[model samples]
Target: MTARLNPDLLHRPGLAAYRLSRALALSRIGSWHSYAVIATPRAGMPAMPKGYSYRIAAHMGEFEAVAGVAGVDLAVAQRRLDDGCVCLIASRGAAPVGVTWISLKPVREDEIAALYDCGGRAAWDLGLHIAPEHRASRAFAALWAATGDWLDMHGLAWSLSRIALYNAASLRAHARLDAQLVGRVQALQIGRLQWLRATIGGQTTLHLSGIARPPKLALAAAIMV
Candidate 1:
C-alpha cells in the first residue's frame, strides 16, 4: 500500500513543494526523524525534549485552532499554511498544551546586503506564535531553542525573529535566548476615526526584529509577528 498523505498536508505550499524535494533528498541520504521523537516519551509540562525533529505548520487541525483564535478566516489560513511555514505543538499524554508556528526562509539578497551593509550576513524571519497558556513553561523555551536548532541543523546559518515592542514577555524570552533588538519597522493601516483617534491618530503597529547571535541567542531581528 502507498503511504497516503494527509489532505490537510496537501494545502501547505512549502510542505507540498519541500516535501517532494525533501523526500528525494531523504531517499538518497536522510529521512525526517523529529516527529517520531516528538510523539515519544512525552514530558509532563514541556512536550518537546532536547533533540532533533522535522518541523512544519501545515497540519489542518492545529491550523484551525490558531486561526479561530486569531480570527483568521479558514481559506486564508489554509493558503498560508500551505506555504513554507510551520506549526509546532506541545502535547502531554495525548493532551495538547501549546502550539507555535514558524517559517523557514532565507533573507532576500537585498535584505542580506542590507544586513551586511549594517555589519551582518544571514537572517531568517519568524512570525509564528505560541499559545498563551504555555507561556513561561519549559516547553516554550524548548520550542524557542528548537527553532534555532532547526536553522543550524538545516544550514540556515543565521536567523531572525520579530517581536512586538509592547510584548514584554516575548522581549524577555528572546533576551533569555540572547536575541538582540536590531531595528524597528512600521505598519500602516487606515481605520475608523474612533480607533485611530484613540490610538495613533490613524497609524498602525510598529514591530521589531530580534536576530540570533550564533550558537547563542537570535542575532539580528525583524518586526512582524
Candidate 2:
C-alpha cells in the first residue's frame, strides 16, 4: 500500500515545518548517517538535571502520558509500547518533559534495518524529545545517558540511532556521546516510484532500484522517526 502521510503531522505547523525542511534538505543532500556506540560504561554520564527524574514507562497509560507531553500520537506510542519498546520518560515532579525510546529488537526503516542481524546484541534508539522550555537544559543529554545505562544493564553491547543530514543539533548531540557513523541511507520518492540506497562502513550494501506501491506502515514509521 502507498503510505498515506500522517495528517496530524501535516496539520501541526511545527511538525509540518520540520518535515518540509527535512524533505527539502534531503532532496539536496540525499542521505542520513547511521550512528552506533558500544554500550561500555562511560565516565560522566550526565545526571538527571536538578528537578528531573527518569523512569521507564511500565504500561500503556504511562506511555500515553509521555506521548501527550511530547505531542505525539497515543496510538503510535501504544503500538511501540506493546511491541516491547521501552519509553524512558523524564519528568519534573508530575509533568513529563522528555522521552526517548529504545527497541531491543531490530528496527527497520523502509528497506534498511538498523544494526540488522546482530544476534540480539543491539538496540535502536529513536523518538527523542524534550520540551521547548527545556531545550538547552541538558535534559536530552541526561536522557541519552540514561538510555546508555539501561542498555548496559540489559547487556546489550550496541546502541544505534539515525541522524538526518539536515539535523545539525541531533548530529552534535550524538557526537557528544561518541557514536560512530557506521552507515548511510538515502531514499527518494516520485509519484508512485520509490528508491532506496544504503552504505555501511563506506561500502554500498543495500541498493533498491525501485518499489511500486511501497508499504505505507513501514514508510510512515520511518518518516515519524
Candidate 3:
C-alpha cells in the first residue's frame, strides 16, 4: 500500500497566532515584524528531507547580500517591516536555504479600490525571497505555490505581491504564476551638505545642487485581478 503523507503534520499552528500578536504589540511601539510561512511543494517529499526545514531569522546580516543584490538597503527595509520576523526555508537539516518575509498591512483602497470597478478585489502584501545557494532547487517555486495556499487558507484570496524592477528571477517566477504587473515605484534619496555654506544676512545657506532625493526604485505589483 502506498502511504500518503499529510502536510498538516509539519505545521506550527498556535505559533502563527502568537507571532501575529507579538507583531501587533511591536507595531503599537512603532515597530513592525515581517511574518512569512515557508512554502513547500508537498509533504510526500518527506517532512524536511533530513536536513531541510523552516525557521525564523535571528540575524540582520544574513539578508544583507540578498538585499544588496536586489538593490534594497536592509536598514531601510527593517524599519518598513516594522522590525518583523523573517522566516526562512532551509535545506540539509535547516541551514537556511532560502527565506520568505511577510508584512501584514491593510490593503489600501486608494491603490486597489479601482479593482472593484474592474470586477476584482484587494488582498494582503507579501515579500518573498530565496538564497543564492538554493536558487537551482525547487525551493523558490515550491515556496511561492505554498505561499498562495497559505494565503487561501487564511481567507486571503485577493493577495498582492511586489517585486523589485531589477530582480529578473523574481519577475519570471511571478510571471509563471500569472501575476500581472500593475504599477511602478521610484526610490529617491536626499542628504545635506555639511561642509559648504554661504552667509546671507547672517544666515548660513548651503550650496547643494546635487543634493537631490535618490532615484525612485521601481516596484511592480501583481494580483489575480
Per-model TM-score versus the true fold: 0.45, 0.67, 0.42
Candidate 3, 114-166: lDDT as tens digits: 11111123333344555666668766544554455444444544434433333
lDDT of 3: 0.36
Per-residue lDDT value at 171 in model 3: 47
Tally clashes: model 3: 20
Number of the candidate with higher TM-score, 1 or 3: 1
Count of clashing residue pairs in every prediction: 22, 0, 20
Pairs that clash in candidate 2: none
Superposed on all Cα atoms, the candidates' RMSDs to the truth, in angstroms, are 19.7, 10.1, 18.9
Q: Put down candidate 2 lDDT per residue, 17-122, tens digits, no spaces.
A: 3576567566864432322211222332455567777899857876765675665577767766765678888877677778988876654442232323323545
Off by over 4 Å in 2: 1-45, 110-118, 209-225
Relative to the true structure, how large is the alpha-carbon lDDT of every model? 0.36, 0.55, 0.36
